[model samples]
Target: MDDRGGAPAPPEKISAVPVRHPGRWVAAAVLLVLAAMLVHSLLTNPNWKWAVVGQYLFAPRVLHGMLLTIELTALAMAIGIVGGVIVAVMRLSPNPIVSGIAWLYAWFFRGTPVLVQVIFWSFIAALYPYLSLGIPFGTEFVYFDSNKLVPIFVGVVLGFGLNEVAYMSEIVRAGILSVDRGQTEAAEALGMTRTKIMRRIILPQAMRVIIPPTGNETISMLKTTSLAAVVAVGELFTTVQLIYGSNYQQIPLLVVASLWYLVLTSVLSVFQYYIERHYARGTVPLRARGFRFGRAQGGLS
Candidate 1:
């Protein structure tokens, strides 16, 4: 400073910033209130049937129904995902006819209620007593009785899967669109063909956006399979209904179905968390392993 002929600066001061986190207190209060309510309910309720709950929770038939629910969900979701991808690609195709057809497919399915679709499929025999597939202006390639062709299980799959395709098409399209335009342009600049760009560059990147929604759709589809009960598909809820209809143990049977659904949702949620964490890697920063309370490094002593 003396050599440069400038005034010497005073020593700078360091001050610690107090972090504000009023939300933590709010959360703690909310948890305490919920605990109190739970305790009060447990202490006051006398009609809670713990014995019935325990007896029905692990029944063999209930386990079978749960297994059926899982199978139905898995099959429907597989069909939906494959069909949805096709529809999404068709919708994005350059040809007006292809895009328009895809648009109409999505529009009709998404616009109609799924329950109506299921009912219609179940009663398809009323419209056409026989099922036939053939080339236009040609003899029938295959024929079968409509009753045999569209059973309750098939009806449920067609209804749920077709409707899911429409919803999942939108999800896939959104994921594809979320990729930056520049990425596509850059791929093209590198002499990549459109197919190569989509396969190699676009889809891989778009997966980050695609996976969460797909997981959510899968979970929703699992619950949505309950609607198959209306068609007498003998899935979880339908099985419970059958039991209760015969035995008149409505509450306990219903509870069993509800518990199975809860278990299914819990398992799916855990899977979703792990998948989200896997994708979140490299996108989010990791923090030091420590706890900090509101406006302090430690909680109240």
Candidate 2:
């Protein structure tokens, strides 16, 4: 009811306008120009030798080398994951000696360059020509020649695996530490053993933190296996080197290796995405959790 005994007049309409971002337009134009230039250079440069890349991309020897690379990656990561978990638990041990030894292992492996470690393992026979298994300081029951025991492939795997163990230990330790102390105490209150608490309560919750870095390490291991080329381990890079060494088609062969690595890493990345999504259930909205890989609902396309 209005004071004049009539309905009040409707409020006047107000208009609104969207904001403009001129800087975004400028940035987009610059990026487009750079991309066009790069594409033109790649297409016009006669030296890329795309035909040779195509020719040797699926060659028998190349495929064999790729298979070896995959094997090395899988084995190394398996060793790293298992060894890392053990070392991580050792690092958290109450005994000073155990913790100190674990710390020293991580320090030594992480402080040195991986290439140096690989080379050292490759030539370790020079340090100790024989290895024995028996009592620590008593009669030996079995002996093995170092040269036979640690071949180039085994040496390379040990190098990659041990070095990765150091890195993954720290990663696992961080994940374990990320879990709340209250949870462990609560588990203790419920009469759970320490091992049970860790296995059933802490680790499951900690996996969300552990998984992303572990996935990254796996992908990194895929690329780092190329280092085996230095020791003539016949991996992808080594195979490519042998091919290009004879034909002098170094650039194309390298491009082939790079393409294969990109493809493998891309596949690993997709797996990582799904693994992260699985562990992220109940914490984040599904649509906003990771890359959608689908139609955009709104915002920047």
**Which has the greatest TM-score?**
2
Please write out the lDDT profile of model 1 over residues 22-121, one tens digit for every residue.
Answer: 9999999999999999988755775445566678778787788888899889888887888988899899999999999999999999999989998887
Where model 1 places Cα greater than 4 Å from the true spot, the runs are 1-31, 39-46, 189-191, 286-301
Best by lDDT: 2
Q: TM-score for all predictions?
A: 0.82, 0.91
Residue 23, candidate 2: how far off, in angstroms?
Answer: 1.6
**Which residue pairs show backbone clashes in model 1?**
none
Any runs in candidate 2 off by more than 4 Å, and if so which? 1-11, 286-301
Model 2 weakest 10-residue run by lDDT: 292-301
Per-model CA lDDT versus the true structure: 0.85, 0.94
